[model samples]
Target chain A: MPLLAEGSFNLLSVDPGLVFWTVVTFTLVLLVLWRYAWKPIIEALDARNDKIEGDLKKSEDLRKEAEDLLKSYSDKIDSAKHEVNGMLEKARKDAEDLRNKILQTAQEDATIVKDRSKNDIEQAKVKAIREIQELSVDISLKLLGNVLNQDVNDEEHRKIVLRELEKLKSSN
Target chain B: MLSVMNSLALVFALTLAQAPANNQGQIVPLQKVESGVSAKETSVKEDGAEAASADVHESAESFDLNEVINHHLGDVRLRDFYIMGYNFPITKRVAMMWVAMTLLLVILIPAARSISRNAAKRPGRFTSMIEVFVTFIRQDVGENTMGHHSRSYEPFLLTLFFFILFCNLIGLIPPMGEIAVKAGELFGYQFHLEPGDIPLPLKIWSGITPTGDLSVTATLAITSFFIIQISGLVYQGIAYIKNIVPAGIPWIMWPILWPIEVLGQFTKPFALAIRLLANMTAGHMIILVFLGFIFQFQQLAIIPLSISISVAIYLLEIFVALLQAYIFVFLTALFIAGSQHRH
Candidate 1:
């Protein structure tokens, strides 16, 4: 090695004085700065970070709440629409039932009227036929009694008249 | 090791070669010291004279490579600066330590105030930058390394980082030692400055960086070493010492392993001190050497080359300044963490 200056100029040599001063300076800096600087700054930074995180979490919760509200609203609207459709279906079924009842009542009324008219007509026809048959029998009895001047209530004459009338009715 | 030996040989050869050219016609007055010698003491006295002459010869030269390297690496004495017939004796290392601390105060005091006052608001750019470093050290270095126990040590780690950072950066400012001497020589010739008529740098300070000094770095390492021990004690309590040996090691192997573990403890801090000292010293030495080359060769052709090389090294030194500071703090955290957690 190139020779070094003998006194107070060695690179490896430690000055006790310097060491003492450095320790003092370093210790003082640590103490003063710890109290003044690092503690407050770190606390503030942590607080800010915590605040930011809290805000983010709060926003997330609010978003979830809104989403839930929206879901419920849509569900309400869906159920209302379903209820309206059900009501409309029930109304349509009611109208259809009313129309069927009216048609059934009209058909029954027409059938009952037509049957009564037919029964009335058939009764009138039966009465007219009975009158005609009674008149024919009376005329025949009167003419026979007046012309012959005999007893009209006799059994042989009445039997003959009735038998003739029966033959006539069969031929007609 | 071989390379170091080889480089020493080269330096010796260069010094031997430069001595003759530098000392061509210079003669020392040996008669002044040769008078008071007995016969038995004559040889010893002559040897002393020879040694003194050698020292004179070495000092008389413009610059030697090793001398410049050592000069750059060595501590500055407070004796270099004196005021009004009073000598305030302290090493430049301590003075530079004070400078670094002062710079820290200048930067951090305002930053701390701003951070506190505007706790809710977003920080400004400068405040944000400082916050980034503070948070990084607290969370990344402190928490990541020491976990829950990191809270107690973050301030110390921050101090260490900024202190060494400032020291290294301030050291890289080419020590105005030679320039100041030249300026004083020029002033001596041109005019005289009476008491209190000089600048502070000229009167009160020498251009020295503290982190480059071994004593400062050693103190730091020693402090870190103690902190490591204290942290271990705090976290591990009475069981701290038991952490040194591997848990599953055979009882017989404890004798072998214990010394290694203990040695590891001292070596860690020792390595820390040396790493910082050597890094800061080497960067300064490279810059000094490059600048010294221009003078050593005294050639017009080497001027630009030396300037360019010195500039390059200076840039690298800047990077080294910041990097070495980070490495020192990072390793200190790692060491403290290691001590606490053991495995």
Candidate 2:
């Protein structure tokens, strides 16, 4: 039995001594590595990660500041546009008011000149009618004296003027 | 595709049939072992007879396929190496394991020191590659799988990956057994080797790769098993025992379900150990068997063909080495993760 057992390779069985050695070596190596290598290695990797994260955050902050500056500049531009629009509206209103005042003053002066011309024409017509009437009355008196060969007194002259005025009225 | 597979199946069957015939041809002692038979009479069979070529025929008849295959697959303690009169008996498995461990230390310890000194600087190319492996485990396996326990288990998972990867890759390097034999001779110690004759308990399946042996894989799996249980206990305290039977099962079913779940725990590690051992061992065996084809045929014409086929398998074995290492780490992380969440 021993001779046969010593010549074969049994795949299923375990050697306890080998297993013990394997565990011992594995544990020893693990302990040595954990102390000498793995701890610092993990720390260094974490530190690299932290550095990368910090850089990303700084860039993000700078980007946000630039956006804010851009927004403020746009706000200033918007306010300037509003002020220019207000000044343009006010200038347009003032020009409209000045034009209205000029038109109103021209209309008033035209009315005053038309009224004075109308009064002068009326006065001139009245004075010309009076002169014509006196001339006609004198001519009629001279003609009467020549034809009758008689001197006329004041009362007689007045009565003749009144009679002539009354005859003109009766005729109208 | 079915017909093609059928044809390959036929080809494979033909090779299988051819192997035994070739082996029989070498072992039958056809014209070489007759007592009192003259070399001239053996060589004079109505064909081209050369007395000098009878020795060639005798030499070719001794190649035993089973014995050669067994010697390559089987393990034993080779001759001991004596240094300053202190004899050290070294098996091929142990030597290969030492090589793997030494290689990992050489690469990782320096890279680790570089990072520790100036951590702010970016890693160089080789360091970056190592970082890729480390970060892959940290992020993909550890953090993604174990969550809170990721940081705690990172170093262990890293070590397991490097160890297994080195073992698998080192096994692919040829002539390791021959190298052990030569080392024994160099030390002026000659031990009688009964090749292919060592029995089960005395045999140490050797070439390279301790991972190819159950002793190594079982140890690794057992360690993982302990970690799994301990982490579960630590995280859940005594309540972790409640995880033995899943929630929502009836009280009546507890007896049946409890044993099954407990068995399931053990079976997982068993499978883990077997998967790695079988993969590494099978790859090495296939390469050895392919090379054995040259011996089985004993023809110079078939040597090139056998070598080319073995080279193709060699490339696949290299890919498997990396893949199996990743898989081992991945599964260990998965098991650790599973322990954290009981269900």
Candidate 3:
């Protein structure tokens, strides 16, 4: 083939100088890039990946904390609502008891006052009737003396009047 | 898009159908034309393509596809560098390797600094872009293949990957020689360099793919081979020799299996070198071949089709360049991993 002909270019020909240079170039590149390029770059990539994973874990933890806080706050609010309801119920019951006690005391005082007033009326009526009966007996004795009627005694007259009044109160 | 496809199909059919017959007719003339060009280069070093009418017609009639393909794929010796009483001949590929090296240092050193500086913060676009490649080699290629031992081999793998990748990508760009020639034409001058007469500037700026050269790839594969063997020895000690053959085979089979297993070790790297060299070289060769069709047919009608196909192949070449770099490192990692274990 013309491609492999003598003095013509051979694609497979090995040039030792080129090989040497390639080796030198590649070795230098590997060393230099490893120090300045590949090492730090790779480290940075790892750091970034780690940072990402860490951030995700941190956020996850924060979300869980927030949920816990929410739950606790809701629980607190529920308890406060329950306490307020209990306080209201206790206040209403206490007010009802106080009202019932006040009504009982007022009714007792009113009954005592009414009974005392009835006794006062009964005493005044009996005293005033006794006084009037004695005054009528005195007038009858003075008129009998003037018209030939002799004075009757006070004790007998009072006794007769009280007995007759008692008979009349009973008959009426 | 359909027309482009149709035109490409027509070109492929025509070339495939007529290539052998056409080769039979033109082979002698093609060789003659190659010799003529060389003779012309030597005789008329300064005057560019000032030929007789008959010679022009002959040159037009014969275009050697092999010469064009080889010219692109083969290495050109630029000059000899004498250092410490030793002569080191610098080829285009050697210079390109240096270019790739310089490029890696220029682009990556700062990226490394930036990464180290802002390791906690999100990196900039450029730094992050480089980090993606470095991380891919470390994690995807290195860690996946070698597992925990990947860390130890990362620097080598990363260097191998970026170096080869840069070389492959740089190859796709138009070489300084071609660009210089075109620039010379625009200025009404022709830039022609006799073999070994490349200017210092042109030599420095030569843009060939180092990985496409067998010598370079062989060097890389040789390094990988050593690393693999050493890793095997380091992990398994001197017993690595015995471990090359799988365990549980009959003791009687040892005599037959040992040599083949050893040979398999060498062949793995051999395949790596050739695979890289061929893949990198073939893409450029195919592109040149497609473009060569235009001159071969000597018709304006072939230009569009040839260019379109070349463009398509060129795009595929870009993908192939990255893929081949990835494959080289990945396989090296696999080989290294394989050596570290018995089965």
Top-DockQ candidate index:
3
Q: What is the TM-score of each candidate against the true structure?
A: 0.67, 0.65, 0.80
Residue-by-residue lDDT tens digits, candidate 2, B145-260: 97867998988988888788887876665433343433554686444534323222222323456787798899899888998888888877888777867778899998899899
Q: At residue A25, what lDDT does model 2 achieve?
A: 62
Model 2 Cα lDDT, one tens digit per residue, A1-172: 1212222244666655456557766776677667666777788888988988998998899999999999999999999999999999999989888888888888888887888888888888877865666566666666666666665435678577868876997899
- Chain A TM-score by candidate, in order: 0.55, 0.53, 0.71
Best by lDDT: 3
User: Which 10 residues in a row give candidate 2 chain B its minimum summed lDDT?
Assistant: B27-36
**Higher-lDDT candidate of 1 and 2:** 1
lDDT scores of the candidates, listed in order: 0.70, 0.66, 0.76
Question: Which residue runs of candidate 1 sit more than 4 Å off their true CA positions?
Answer: A1-9, A87-172, B1-63, B66-73, B79-88, B174-199, B203-206
* lDDT of each residue in A97-136, candidate 3, tens digit only: 9999999999999999999999899999988987786676
What DockQ, between 0 and 1, does each candidate earn? 0.18, 0.15, 0.34
True contacts kept of each: 0.46, 0.31, 0.60
Clashing pairs in 3: A144-A149
Docking class of 1: incorrect
